[model samples]
Target: MNALPRRRPNPLSCLAGSLLLTAMVSSAAQAAPSQQLIDAAKQEGMLTTIALPHSWCGYGEVIAGFEKKYGIKVNELNPNAGSGDELQAIKANKGNTGPQAPDVIDVGLSFGPVAKQDGLLQPYKVSTWDSIPDDAKDAEGYWYGDYYGVLAMGVNRDIYPESPQSFADLNASEYTNGVALAGDPRTGNSVMMTVYAAGIANGGKAGADALNAGIAYFKQLKDKGILVPVNGTAQNIAQGTTPIYFDWDYNLLAMRDKLDGNPPIDVVVPSDAVVAGVYVQGISAYAPHPNAAKLWMEYLYSDEGQLGWLKGYCHPIRFNDMVERDVVPQALLDRLPPAENYRKAIFPTLKAQSEAKTAVADNWAREMGVQ
Candidate 1:
């Protein structure tokens, strides 16, 4: 037995054993790299973000916290840009490793799949991925919803003493030329969601067919001279130029605070329908600082990060989860609309959203005579 040394289990077997060991080690090395990622990101020392307005969803605090926590500098580009602009920036700066490139984006929910399809987004699931709702995230992690807002009617009480409580109330003769939208539904996500909410209020559902009802509703507003052509803004509301504006609850809430009793602003999620729209976060496919992007995602989805959004009046995507875990502060929770108000809140399926968007784009001008 000692003579052959048991043939050493054969030379070919030894080679196979060595290959298996190498593969195992490689896999282990690849799988356990959280600390490695942190180190690499620290070395990079920089990140680039696009279209993140400081006021939107509390991004200012988030960016500041991230920089302070990691000592990484974040270069924000086009803070006032729209979701469409964000996608264009990614395409325009593709393959560029300079400061101009965007490392991450937070876009409207409809734009998430579009970015993924264009190969502009990379898959990255944060540590809190499990807590996120299935409907709010891509299965493969290409993108995930960070926060959502309900479409609400914002009324300047100085202009309309009796605030509109329902979408139907906006159609009253008294509200003629009073209703305004944040932007054209053809181009703005908020406006699009407003139209969708109208559809839901009018006995229509949330699919392709339902979109026609939305268009019809807007068309009627336009015909009755109730729909103002001007884009709605907090300034416009404060000035009484567009007293009754259709906008996200968060925006209206912030506006109410900014107005601060000079002209009381009232926000009401239409009693007839409560519809919520989501904003998604994604890492750029060509991110120059990939690890830093990952770290940012982790921060955005963490309890601390979700709370930041809450501080800004936007509903975090994991709000329900946070409530269940009792992680949400009682004071903050109290500020939110009573839970019963959200009982009827409806979210359109991704397919329905795509179809509805197409419907809006195709017929908005024809139906309402405004593009």
Candidate 2:
């Protein structure tokens, strides 16, 4: 599968390398974009933008499609710049430039609030806004998650003939020191979601007692010298330098295709528990073309827009619509955890997420020197 275009790159190159996930098709009950939003976006003529962090390679297809459909022009910026830098670039260029700033911003869930608080983000809910679940979007319409990734442990069968089923299994001496840590949670957005996943596996807020279990899980792997740190690809795992990895389900699944043999890789959303971590997108408060930015969001969440995500392997946020249309492969659908299980998947409310942010950072610093 092709890589989706990344919005911006961060300095934490190492941690950014390992996380992955795929598309989601939201419900038709969810709001669909209005013809007006679509028409206005086209009139804007050009859509200039930036997407934070980077991931698979198919995003260009989405951008290209939107431009093709609307006859609007889109210029996606580089993927190597961090969100901080990308935001600064827009702030720095305020009012003077013709391009102004990006029409949209895609980022990790945690950072969405941070950007909102920083007064960096603008709010505009697409006409089809009602379709988004409350938890998936801001009430004020500042941002909404287009898709998400569930945390899953991936084993490089080449390195470990035996696959790991749970975090407890991962901590076992047999697999100890063989797993690769995704890198510092502080610098990488996806890994931050991993930390939150660890929280869910340990037991949400009630899992405070088990938080140590989560910490010890990583500690054991680290102390065993079995845990290897890698970014997005499975190069280390495939080469047998690292036998196990924990990453976004979509990422691990996608990476397996790059290997030569079956490679004995298994990625499972821990039945032990899971978290609904998200990658979000929203219109820039100062978008060069606000209408186009709103249109982009509408397109992304629409049936056509979400299909690209499924084709690319990111689990679509809205599955009911996609499955009916057969946008995703039945074979792929079979690989996913049950939909009801998704409801069981923990997604921290914004307040809960804010708390996790500091706690995750502080704990990582104290426990793994990650911050």
Candidate 3:
């Protein structure tokens, strides 16, 4: 009789309970990432790698900030590989590489085309795309420049107390046997770009023919025995081994911090003939973490990201809004000589660059005897 009294089972109630349990398990499985996971990898903390040839221009700060914000550590490798070497490394490790291909690359403007042609770049239309100057990036979205450096003279004050003020001054007899260069046209893209820049500083495309003047300028220095084929190096500038060197303004500003006493170095943005050359960044086509890479690209071109260059004495290619909002500090701005100095900086079209390169090499060999 007691057993029969307990047999008041509700079939509907048991079915409802079964359905509720199933629903609860499904919801648990589909639950969104917790704050912790989001903190660890906003999109995905997978991993990001960059090939940065330039020394850390306070980039460490940028990395630290990004890591803290996204909960992902950024791995930056500044291999000594120049433009050629960097490309080769990527090509060599294309398939059998690590988790990510060189996710990001920073090279001279000339390398952008080289990389693009090799099919090494991934295209992404960044949020800041419109802000970038038309001439500074690929309209199709292959690469974008985050910072730029002007072709200027790096003068060692200890050696050349009276630093040359213009490119014209550099060619004077006094600078003979004193001006240093990394390489002639043989393997130096910077040298080549500088020649092109000189042409622009002299007069944009109309100035294209004027690049010959750069070779002539070098010829004078070589004749005076002042042309010391010393590539840009601290040893050359610090020991007064070579009093003058031609390079992007960033290097000169950087040397000020790299060498002890920096030897009272002076960087001049030749008001008359300075050309601005850009350092470009691109995402690898085979990026393992394409999503993360895209996000990183966006961050780099953002107001916060580009302004980080100020810490390294590099100028932001975009983010003029930050300057307008005073988001960047004055001290950092001071490190940059002046944007107007680059107003006349020449940027050759891709087609013109091809012609210009050959022209520069031929002229340098005959005039500067670089060969």
Candidate 4:
């Protein structure tokens, strides 16, 4: 369906690709949260979350629903903080039992293991833990995948009437001084993954090889003056400065709705290379409200919580389970970008992401002139 009026392209095409799920097996009825857990959380009184901007993954409504249901205050800190910042906050406030310390964190998949290994996380398996994909969670329950977003581009139609079809299309001079990433490629997982996708599109293998290829592609863009050093944000998109901004599909979808087609925005998951990024959720080791933190996890892993994320265009860790049970709302399913685009999308292994992180952090500045 058309995204808006007469000429506007759908922000997302109806997805047609199979979700690479190994746990599409059927399951019994869901186990609702235990009353004991809910009571304990209420006694603790508050849950502090970090790096959860409402627009990121339908978090605004989810948080509100939790607070309303349990009457537990959710003290949000640094709405714009990145995964690194969340980890830093946890370390810095290990001794302080105050609002500054985060009780829960939603971070890149790679950060989950790091945080657990660093003694910054505590394990508490949700009741529906069995439904969560094995690859998306820690066996010991220290961390778990909350939701995932596919790498996609947000194109401003005001500047270029036609949308770029693939990563290679961005190399055209027409996008000169316009190509950007929502995050800094040198340190941001999303941006790094974008590079990975581009690299794969340019004929690099997945993981380290793709990252190298991506770097080479960027170099080409840099030589052509088609790449911009600026971090693309919603404001920048509206301003028409960064006309072609590569970012998570959820983020771009939110921007599309927010913009309401003012200048028009197209969220396209490039056909050449499709990559999905999963963000994990963990309870901070130093959480002052441990019970509250546990309760928060229970709420999130529950169908209600997973559906909350789906409403925001995020594919929850329990997506396969939900779909198998025929629980996902058809309306939401219809809005997803066509699955054919995601046919080749690969969820990079932790090893791949780690290697990419190292490669980009070490070489971005020296080779591309910016970190």
Candidate 5:
């Protein structure tokens, strides 16, 4: 979310504004799916999807759940690929009816409009379309946000008694040679967002200027030997090699529980700046199984599907709506980090994120004078 203003209306506040809207839309949205659509989807039998990592967003179970519900097979492709690769897949397989072609894509929000402009995407609004915030989706249903996550500090509590509450805390001499990114900023969304979030904390805004300032800040960390070059991982954090890692809140919290006290880590959404990053979903214009792709969209925006993402710690686009309606289970809400942190989170526009991504890629290493 290197959220420009960060998309937030606490669960309670959302009700005051959304309750009327929700009531107006509920009747139409609750209508059952026409048998014709289901029949067509069944006839297609398969839906090819791309760039969905099982561990990243509880996708392993999501896929299994979808398959179980529909008897349709989901053929996953290049689970580790990026948003750019997802677009390339659509371009390269335009006329191909093979399994290699993706029926649907879940990519960075920025790529949605570009894909639409490129004529690579098809439009299909889900049953719960109104629940998706207008700003997070296109007017024509070309693409819509599925879920979002905020970046946070993952501190190995075994090494440090307290977590760093803000970016400035990283400068503490005790944190020397301890900080690292979840992955390389030049190549990864989460990594680039970490830089963007740091820049905001350092007083830069949500666009390119903030990105350049972020790059400069990282250079300072490097010069002081405070920010190490290695990519952060659960195993390395457990090993205490990357004691202070900047990464998504969901990952750090998940890893903390998985580690089970061997190395307790504090996943702190820094007090100074909170950035929300959202990923969007779209169907391929040339999809071999158009009905199936549309069916997948319907399922994803449904309560079951949204909950699947929420289970994985992601904030589903319909989360506040569900919260207002009391549909989210208390146990699930209990598992997440504080809601107050998300209140202050900024959700940067796709333009801001695109500019930030480019700035980080073009200047991160060059500005630091690193080869």
Candidate 6:
């Protein structure tokens, strides 16, 4: 019978096998598009950032490094604007395709969900998404914390001779007309947290309903003539105009170099209460250069980015992660206060923060007699 023809594998089976293999290859290829994203971002060639001060959180170096690495130009707007100003810029420039419209924003932590609710932000998780703490990020990736700092007392040593180490010390006759806040409590997150910290020192808990103690504490400072009405600035601190500032630790730490230590600025995390506040990053809903914004996000969360913030004395959100990985530099680590100081650091819950903001805004001016 002509030597029975060798049985042939089914042609249909071979075709189906080829198709499945092709699909698998395509799926693997689509797994990550980081390189594709870089190419697209390069094509965009420009990024717009709002309210990012080069000196704040090492943004100056971060922006320079990004520009050098990608050859994309960054247009920084309103370097001195506050978190509220950043949000306002996005809303004001909505639907515009110009440089005035911000591509990314770094705002007070409480503003993250607010932006998300207002549809001002877009969801985009970075390659290191899993590395971020779940509680520090939005479920849909609308925003994630970049860095944080503790509210501390920054005293001009030349003016005070001896620095106050506790919130209660500000009420002493020695600090009369010396105490000032970073900004108005009614609108500034730093100022609000300062009050919150004071309240904690006065036996108040960290909750919306528990801010009365903080309010009373500030009222006492005002009554004693220790609370200055002017906002504390580096210039004011250097000139001894606002010799004792209740501000962020990073800001005070930066003043040491900014003022050349003429009088020397002493930063103290109060023994009674250590309150920490976070700053969050988000991509604009109407980013003119979307890919570049995404790339910026990736850079900010990367090891290089986190270390950059650390260099500026701001604790990166991934600070603990860096510690575990042994990636932080020894010098930078040494600059921070002892671990014990942060052991009692208390971060407000989102609900608590919103409540606290409202409480401050509604009662600050009325209670303290300053707008």
Instruction: Supply the global lDDT for candidate 6.
Output: 0.78
Best prediction by TM-score = 4
RMSD of 2: 8.3
Q: Write the per-residue lDDT of candidate 5 for residues 1-371, one digit (tens) a residue.
A: 11123344432111212211111224323444567888899999999999887777788888999999888999999987777788999999998999999999998777888899999999888888766777778989999988888889888998998788999888878888899987677656777888998898898977787788788888888889998878788888889889889877876777777788888888899888877788899999999999999988888888888899888888887776777767789999898776677767677777788788788778887887766
Over 4 Å off, model 2: 1-60, 71-73, 78-101, 203-216, 258-264, 321-344
Which pairs of residues collide in model 5?
Answer: 1-276, 1-277, 3-346, 3-347, 3-348, 4-347, 4-348, 6-345, 6-346, 6-347
Write down the worst ten-residue block by lDDT for model 5: 12-21
Whose TM-score is higher: candidate 4's or candidate 5's? Answer: 4
Q: Could you tell me which residue pairs clash in candidate 4? A: 13-338, 14-338, 15-337, 15-338, 15-339, 16-338, 16-339, 17-339
| lDDT per residue (tens digit) for residues 1-371 in model 6 | 01112242221111212110010111111123389898999999999998777767778998998898789999999887777788889999998999899999998888899999999999998876655556677979999988888788888899988888898777789888898888766556777778888888898876555566799998998888988888888888888899988778887877776777787888899888877888899999989999999998888887788888988889886665566656778899887777666666677777777888888878877887765
Best of the two (1, 5) by lDDT: 5
lDDT of 2 by residue, 186-243 (tens): 5555566665566556554522333444565566566776566555347667666666
Candidate lDDT scores, in order, read: 0.78, 0.61, 0.62, 0.82, 0.81, 0.78
User: Model 1 off-target regions past 4 Å?
Assistant: 1-33
Candidate 6 RMSD to the real structure: 13.9
Candidate number with the higher TM-score (1 or 2)? 1
The TM-score that candidate 6 achieves is 0.88
Sort every candidate by TM-score, greatest first: 4, 6, 5, 1, 2, 3
Worst 10 residues of 6 by lDDT: 16-25
- Residues 1-371 of candidate 3 have per-residue lDDT tens digits of 01123233221111211110010111112122235434434565554565553454456666676677666657555444455556665686678446535667777676787789899987877765655655567878888767766667778887788888876666666776678775554345567766665554445453337566556555666787878877756668778777777776766777777775658888787766645556778877776556666666666766677777767777666534455445677777776665556555544445555565667756777776545
Runs in model 5 with CA error above 4 Å?
1-25, 28-32, 369-371
Error of 6 at 17 (Å): 58
Clashing pairs in 1: none
